[model samples]
Target: MSIVERMKNLSEKECPVDILRKEIAGSKCSDCGKCVFGYEGVTQLQMMLGDITEKKGKGTDLALMKELCALMKTQSLCEDGEDVADAVSYALAHHAQEFEAHVAKKGCAAGVCKKFMTYHILAENCTGCGDCLDACEEDAIAGKKRFIHVIDQKECIQCGACMDACDEDAIVRAGAVKPRCPKKPVPCKRK
Candidate 1:
């Protein structure tokens, strides 16, 4: 197949949350305080991300995201908006562990999220079951049978597959090696 045939359309592939996030970020929010009480998922996510960026620690409130996304999915006027809600719902269902880590440890399993996570394996707890290795699509885990496994930080994408695979609960977030985003107050005035 040609590269053109294989290439997917950007709009068709864009994540709904990402679409809303981009729109929200590009605008100069008036801080009308409406979103805090509004029922829109995108707006809710916008408010949450804003609050998180403001260092308000609101990002830890995973429940709120779930609720807001639920509302959006059921009530949004447009499919685009509902897509954001569905994405959140999908994440909640399929990747609850990642969300729990964010709330409980301020870490992201997918290291793709800035300042959210840095994963490691606890050698003492690791039984070398090779579960993490099998789960790790990135090939980040390195170890032989009957020995402790080690995670290669450089190669790890923080996908958390290994964490789920580990029955021994040996995986842990070591904190960010280089924080992707600073947990600082939003650099804008809110009305």
Candidate 2:
């Protein structure tokens, strides 16, 4: 579907900022340097959108993006640039609050952006088998043979490797609100 269609029909699990970032990142608009608006404008949009998804958005990014998109709509040499500009404009007009939340470092409401998510090992579900620890390239998981594993938020890259390697589904991704897991490894509550 087009970016505008996807934006209008966003599911609760979909994040508008992240979605737009992906669309722009994957589009061919930046491949054409025939026009300054088509190339430079879309390139800037790609960078800004990327920063927003990565939680590095500046306070002035929204305004700058609006201005660039407006210029791209009228000055672009091809329909591709105009289409992308329209999609971005529509997203900014309708989902500005979501962009604001990302810029403010609040959190991704849809939990789609990995940067805004935290990994947690549910105390009730952890088997303490150390599979998660083995999967963690960052050594973010701490646990022993029979103790509940705890995730070190500072070290975790939020890669979801622990979640995937967990046979018991102990690891979970949390957004905005974190689960009440122990800060360090603790005795397993499960048998």
TM per model? 0.39, 0.91
Output the TM-score of candidate 1.
0.39
Give per-model CA RMSD.
Answer: 17.0, 1.7
The candidate that achieves the highest TM-score relative to the unseen native structure: 2
* Candidate 1 local Cα displacement, residue 72, angstroms: 1.6
Question: Per-residue lDDT of 4-102 in model 1, one digit per residue for the tens?
Answer: 112222244332233334544443222333442223445557676544422233445667887877776666555544555555566556556644554
**What is the clash tally of candidate 1?**
4
Where does candidate 2 stray beyond 4 Å? none
Question: Global CA lDDT of candidate 1, please?
Answer: 0.55
1-191 per-residue lDDT for model 2 (tens digits): 66667678878778999888888877677676888888898789999999999989999999999999889899998888888899999999999889999999999888889999999999999978999999999988788999999988899988889899999988889998888988788889798
What are the runs in model 1 whose C-alpha is more than 4 Å off? 1-39, 49-60, 116-191
Q: Which candidate leads the pack in lDDT?
A: 2
lDDT (CA) per prediction: 0.55, 0.89
